[model samples]
Target chain A: MLVCRDLVKSYRNKTAVSGISLDVEPGKIYALLGPNGSGKTTWMKIVAGLVKPTSGTITYNGEPIGANTKRKIAYMPTEPFFYDYMTIANVGKYYQDFFDDFDPNRFEELIKQMDLNMTDKAKSLSSGLAAKLKIAATLARKAELYLLDEPLNGVDIIARDHVITAILEAANENSSIVLSSHLVDELEKIIDNAVFIKDGSMVLCGEAEKIRAERGKSIVDLYKEIYA
Target chain B: MFKLMKYEFRKQLLSKIVILAMVGILELMFIYGVIAEKANTVASAVGFFMVLAFISIMFVSFECAFTYSKDLKTKQSYMLFLTPNSAYGIVGAKVLTTIAQVFLTGVVFGTVIIANILFMAAKYHSVKEVIEVVQQFFKEAMQLDIQMDLIVSLLVYMLVYWILLIVIAMFAITLTYTFLANAKFKELVSIALFFLILWGVQKIAEFILPDLAHITSYIMLGATGIYLVLTALFYLGTAWMLDKKVSV
Candidate 1:
């Protein structure tokens, strides 16, 4: 479980995330929907403890996020996060070396399922393949929470389904997965909960089906109404 | 820490191998010219040293700078910083790897040069004469008491100097490269800003401190400690900026 209070992140004179708060529970897929530069990535980074908030606090299970909390949270950035020279196997090895909960066998199986060559350098892979590799690498870890930033962006339609499936397969009853993306339809069928963000603030968030039932509109319709 | 070191070691192994090979080739050329009794041997040896120094400095500086810059530009730093490791560990691994590379290269090159000198002397000059020349050179160049104990102390000092140089160079490279990597204007603006800051810092230090040119060697050792501290500060500052300010 995670909680953020008045989280704000700004760069120089521009505010990226302006005082957003939310609580995430276990065993649920929380889809963070936002347009470009909506501060979804910034909020995710803050929650993951990768970036310090300009002001506000983030707590995981009632304690401030730190080394212990970091050990429990797996974060995949928007960009391909591995070294160029690293092979898929080495990337798995890296996770295994850093996180005790990393399952190399699972990572290898995931790579194989994605049809990724274990010996191929990350830099040599196509963008979609690279994105799959990153997703596989992050999901292989047995962390309590998984924070994926735009895991489907630039991915082919077929690979996008595979990525979504891989992410779904990686989830467990005790773990929570937070995925951020603008592709609302792709996430519509998968995410249990949806958090819609616009201009660095949460416009709406609740159970995906219930929000639709209550509001008499789908997540996609609501997104257009909020932003347009 | 060990994991970090292993990763860095693997990352830098190729660069280290290339450097070693170049050093070995230079050593062989130096020895061959010396054994053949060519008058230009010493000149060539000195030239090789200059080339070696240039290569060493540039290779290490550029490699380090590019590594730091690429992390920011490519957003690979998020992977590093997001891990459950301390910022100290990340920066410390880079610093240690750079220092280790410099140390290994210096040891290999120095050993080759000394071995070549000894081999040449054995073939063409007496051991006593060689010892006398070494003693005279040390005495005249350093103006120090040239006892065995002092020789050991001098070796220690030289080792410290090598470490100091690597630390200072890495610190400067990381600091400049981080700013440049994150800044909007890529060409002259960031570079000019980097150099201006460096120049300003140097000027301030010079203005506040006594002239180092006239300082005694022993006093210079103390000053070198201050330099090392400043280098450490720069390293910490870099880590702080990367950890807190820079967005990936």
Candidate 2:
């Protein structure tokens, strides 16, 4: 479980995340819905401890986010973040070297499932393949919390199924997955919770089914409604 | 910590290989010159090797500094900061890796130069006499005693000074990336800060040891201790800023 209280991140005159507070419970998939510059990535980065919030408190379980929390939280950044020298296999080894929770066998299996060669250079991979590689590397870790920023981005429709399945497999009673994506319909089916963010603030957040029953609209429709 | 150091070394491998490869080729040229008794070729090789030694040492520090700056400026930082490692550990590994590389480079160049001198001494009987004459010339001209203990102490002092220089550069770079990240001229700012930090450390060293003209074992040890303390402060300062302030 993770909790962020009144988080704010400002870059010079612009505010990336503004006074947003939220709790992430265990065993559920959270679909963070937003347009570009909606603070989803920033919030996720803060939770992952990559970005320090301008003024706020963020914690994993009861402890503040640090090296210890990092051990339990696996973050897949939106960008292609692997070293240029890394091959797909090297990326797996890198994760193994850093994270004790990383499972190399699972990484290899996911790499094969994603249809990527072990020796393929990460820098040379197509964007779609790169996304799959990120997913495989992240999901290979049996972390307590997974922060995936736009996991479905650049992934094709057919490959999306594989990605979604891998994501689902990574989520269990002992773990939580917070995923941000623009593909709301694809996510609506799989996500247990939906958090709608706009203009750097949370506009709506609740159980996906409860919101559906009360509002009589799909997550995609809500996305359009809120943003429009 | 060692894992981070390993990756740091890995990141530096290409640069090291290129430098060492050049050194290797030059060594072969020197050997060929010696075998053929070509004075011009031998002199050229020695001169070029000296330049390469200076270039290689400068290149190593700059390369390491640039790597840190690149990590902060680009998405590559996630490859490092995403690990369950603290900023202190990451910075420490980088510093250690730089020292190891400099040490390796020193050893390689030193060994080659010493071996070449010894080889020349064996071949041309006057080479040993030339070394003694050069030592005598330095002692007479500079009034500096060239003893083994003094040479060893000077090497240690130079090593400490180099480490401090690298640490100061890292601190300035980290400051620009973190606290001054939004400034218009962050690169220029870092450059200026680099000099300022160096000057500040120099001033502090002067304060601690007012007279450095006459070098002694105690003076060398004292200077080394001062430099190391300053290095640690800047190193820790950089790591703290990186952990608490840096967004990327």
Candidate 3:
């Protein structure tokens, strides 16, 4: 389980994440629903140990997030993160080199399923293809937790389905997944819980179907209601 | 740690190739000029190649200073930081790789120079004449003793200075990224912090050994000891900042 308490992150000019607290239970797919500047990315980066919180502590299974926590957390950033010289094969090798849980055969299978070439350099791929490649590489890791920020941002509708299925296939009962995206309707089907944020604070959070039933609105409607 | 060093070396693949090629070409040119019995041409080539080697080594060290900052700026760093490596591990791997590189470059260049010296002896028939000229030059110009210990100390201090610059530069870079928001201010702080840290290191070293009045050897050895300690401290400080303060 991932737990954060009163997390606050601020820059010299502004605070990106305010006093927000939350828990991520194991064996569930969670949708971190928020628009731009809603602090979703900052929160996820904090959990991934890429960003340090100003005044709060984050723990995974009772230990503070550090190098050990990193091994169990796989993060896929919204931006293309591979070096320019890295090909698909090189990316797989890279993950295999660093991550003990990374399965190259699984990566190869995902690459085939996504119709991506092994010889393609990561920087040269189209945005959609790059997104697919990112998802494929990230999902191939058998980590305890996965935080995928904006996984569906640049993907087309056809590729979006493949991406969602890939994510679903990656999850198991021993792990948890947190996906941050603006594609609400698509995520509503797979997400078990939804956490809504607005302007660096949580507006609402609960089980996906329970919140929908109680509020008498879809996740998309709730997102619009919270942000707009 | 070695795994990280493997990738670090791989990253400098092109630069290494270019450096080695330059060394090989310069050595071959010097040998050819010697065999051709063109004394002035050989002298000019040796002078030019030494200058080239100096510039290239300085350039490589300059590049090493920014290696960590470069990794942080690129999203590719996510691949590295996400691994189970601590910030110390990450920083140590980089520093160690740089040390290994400098050592390798020095060894290769030194080998070529030794080969040339032996070849010169065989061709020109004059080790004593060469020694006389070098002794005269040192006595007249440098006014320093030529001894085995002195030579070793000179080389050791050179390597120590190289490492000090890199570690201090890294500390400055990481500090700038963590503390300052304005890009201009960040650059300014980095530059300012470098000089300040260097001055601080010297002052502290001097302050700790104030009673060593006239012993030049003791002063040199003492300063070198302080510098090694400072390097280790700076390495730890940089790693701490990366772990505790850096946002990415």
Predicted model with the maximum lDDT: 2
lDDT of 3 by residue, B24-93 (tens): 7878778889999887879877997898778777767766665676787778778778778999998899
lDDT of 3 by residue, A113-196 (tens): 999999999989999999999999999999999999999988988888889899999888999999999888889899999999
lDDT of 2 at A100: 96
| TM-score for candidate 1, residues paired by index | 0.84
- lDDT per residue for candidate 2 within A1-228, as digits (tens), equals 698899999998799999999999999999999999999999999998889999989888889988889999999999998998999999999999999999999999999999999999999999999999999999999999999999999999999999999999998999999999998988998999999999899999999999999999988998999998
**Model 1 CA deviation exceeding 4 Å by range:** B27-46, B57-66, B118-212, B215-218, B228-236
User: What is the TM-score of each predicted model, taking all chains together?
Assistant: 0.84, 0.95, 0.92
lDDT of every model, 2 decimals = 0.77, 0.91, 0.86
Q: Which candidate ranks first by DockQ, i.e. highest?
A: 2
- Model 3, C-alpha of B208: deviation from truth (Å): 2.4
The superposed Cα distance between candidate 1 and the true structure at residue B120, in angstroms, equals 4.0
lDDT of 1 by residue, B20-125 (tens): 7877776777777766867697678769777876787558644655565555556777666677886667777777776666666667767776776688678776
Rank ordering of all candidates by TM-score, starting from the highest: 2, 3, 1
Better of 1 and 3 by lDDT: 3
Model 2: which residue pairs collide? none
Fnat for every candidate: 0.61, 0.92, 0.80
Best by TM-score: 2
Interface RMSD of each: 2.2, 0.6, 1.2
Provide the DockQ value for model 3: 0.72
